[model samples]
Target: MIRGLQLSLNKTQKLRLESALEQLESLSSKTNTNASVAVADTIPVNYEDGVLKGHGTSEMEGQVVATVCGVVERVNKLVYVRALRARYKPEVGDIIVGRVIEVAPKRWRLEINFSQDAVLMLSSMNLPDGIQRRRTATDELNMRTIFEENDVVCAEVRGFQHDGSLHLQARSQKYGKLDRGQLLRISPYLVKRRKQHFHHLDQYGVDLILGCNGFIWVGEHVEAKDDMVVDQTNKSEQQNANSGGSVGSDDQEQSHTSLEIRQNICRIANAVRVLSALGFMVTVEVITEIVDLSSSLNLDIHEMLGAEFYVVVAEREAERRRSSTKKR
Candidate 1:
C-alpha cells in the first residue's frame, strides 16, 4: 500500500495503473487473509490460548496491540507483525553491504542502515597479508589502509556484543572492500534471505550483491586475487635470482571498462530502481524478467524509468502474481 514513486500519469496511464493495482490487490487477498494493522491498533487474538508476543507487538492496557504498520502473523502461540519499511535487523552469517563512516581505535564503524552503527573490529577481518597472525599496534595503525572512510565494503554479521551493538566480520576473500560499483538502497523488507546473495551475470559481465539489508550493489566483476600465491611467486623469483628487484614503471595505463558492460550495468541498476519504486518484491528472478522485458521491447535504459514503462511493469507484475496464485 506504500507507493513511494511519484509519476506524472496521464488519463490513460492513470486508469491502467489503477486497474493493475486493483487486480494485484484482489489476487493477494485471495492468497493471504492476514489482517494488516497500523501503529497502536488492537489485534484480535484469543487470549484463552495464551499468546506469546513477538517483534512489533506489545501489550497495552491488557490488550495485544501492534507497534508497527504491517501484516499480522501467528506461528502457533507466537504472534508478531512483519514491519514493511523498517531498519535492517541483522542476523548472524547474513551478508551485508555498508559504508565506512569512521576509523576508530581498533574498529571501523559503518553506517549499515541499522538502529545503531555497526562495528567491524580489526581482529575480526583478514589483513592484506592474508595471514592469521595477531593484530599488533602496527596493524591497528594501518587500519585505514584496509578500509578508509567512505569506502563501500561487503561483510557478514558476526552477532552482537553485550552492549547491544552489531558486530561484523570479513574473514574470507569474497568479503572485503568493494570498488567500481553503485550502491542502491531500498526497503529492507523487500529483500528476502536466501542461500545465495552474490550473483555473477555471465552474459552481462556484471556482479550483483543483493544484501539482506536492502543495500544492493551493481558493479563490474573483479576476480579475487590470492595474496598467498603472489607471495609464493615472489619468493620463488628471489630464490632463482638474488638480484631480482621490483620494477617501477608508470607507462602502463589503466584499462577502461567497455561501453557494452557499462550500459548493461546501468540497465540492470535502473531495473532494480523501477522495481523498488513499484513496491514489488525484489528478487533475482523478477529483476531478470524486467531486464529481459526491457530488452525485448527495445526500450532504452533511460526509458525504463518513464511513466509508460512503469505502467507496463505494474501490469506485468499483476499478471505474474495472478498466475502464481492460480498455481497455488
Candidate 2:
C-alpha cells in the first residue's frame, strides 16, 4: 500500500505507518466478521427456500459459493458478492465525474472507470443559453465549445442505451464542467451511492464531489446558478459585447483564484488521498476532521502526503472506528 505513493520514507516512518495499518486491520476484522468472504467460500443459504443468485456467485454441489473476494450482500431473496476492488457498476440517476475522451457527432465519450465508456449526448445536456430547444445543426457544430476533449465534467447517469452503452446527462447548472482542482481515483466499492454527493466546504472555498464511480473531484468551489438569473446575465453580457463594452484586461487579470484558496484546495485534496490510501470510506465529516487535524498541527500542505501523515491518519481512523463502535 505504501508503495502506491511516490514518496521517500525513512525507516522509522515506514515502521510507524505499517503498525498503524495493522491496528486498523485488527479493528475492522472485529466489526466486520463474517461479512466478507474469499474466493470459493461457501455462502450459507437456506436450501428449501427460493434463492436468486446475483453476480460473483456460483453454485457447486447445492452450495452457493463466492467467485470473488468481496463482501456478501443480500436483498430480499437475492444474494451477491460485491467485489472489494472492481470497476464501477453504474446505475440510473448516479452522479459521476469523468473526463471527456472523444467528441463524436452529437455525443461525447467519457472514460468513467466502467466496463465501457459512457456517452453524454448533446441533446441530453442543457445548453449554455438555458433553453430547452431541440438540438440544431449549430449546436452540433459548436459541441466542442461546450465540452472539448479532456475536459472534466460532472453529470448524472441517464441510463444504459438499448445496445448497453452507458449514457449521462447534465441538464442542471449544478452538473457541468469542473476546473481549477484535482481529481482522485479510488476503488469504486469505497464510495457508496448516497443522496448527497456534492459537498461545498465554504470555509475553505473548495468543493468535494464524491462521484459514485470513484472519481473524486476536489476543486475550487463554484456557486450554483439560477436559470432565470443565468439567462438574464447572458443577455446583459451579449448586449455589452454588441455595444463594444467587453470587460477590460485588468478585470480579467483579477479573476484568478486567490493563493489562499488554492492552498485550501490542496489541503482538502490531500485529506481525501490519505483516506483512500488507507482503504477507509471517504466521507465529508472524516475529510473535514482530517483537514482540521492538519490545520491544528500546522502541517504544510505538501507534508500531508508524507509517510508520517499517512500513519497519523490510519491511527486516527482506527480510534474513530473504535469509539464509534463503543457508542453503538
Whole-model lDDT per candidate: 0.87, 0.87
Badly placed stretches (over 4 Å) of model 2 are 1-19, 228-255
lDDT of 1 by residue, 235-276 (tens): 455433422221112112223677888888898899999999
TM-score of each: 0.90, 0.89
For 1-328, candidate 2 gives per-residue lDDT tens digits of 5536765668987887777778778877887777789999999987677889999999999899999999999898899998988899999999999999999999999999999999999999987666678899998998887889999999999998899999999988899989888898988888978899999998898999999999999988876765655566685565345334234663375359889988998899899888887778988999999999999989999989887788788778878987888898
How far does residue 185 in candidate 2 sit from its true spot (Å)? 1.4
Report the alpha-carbon TM-score of model 2 versus the true structure: 0.89
Off by over 4 Å in 1: 225-255
Best TM-score among the predictions, by candidate number: 1
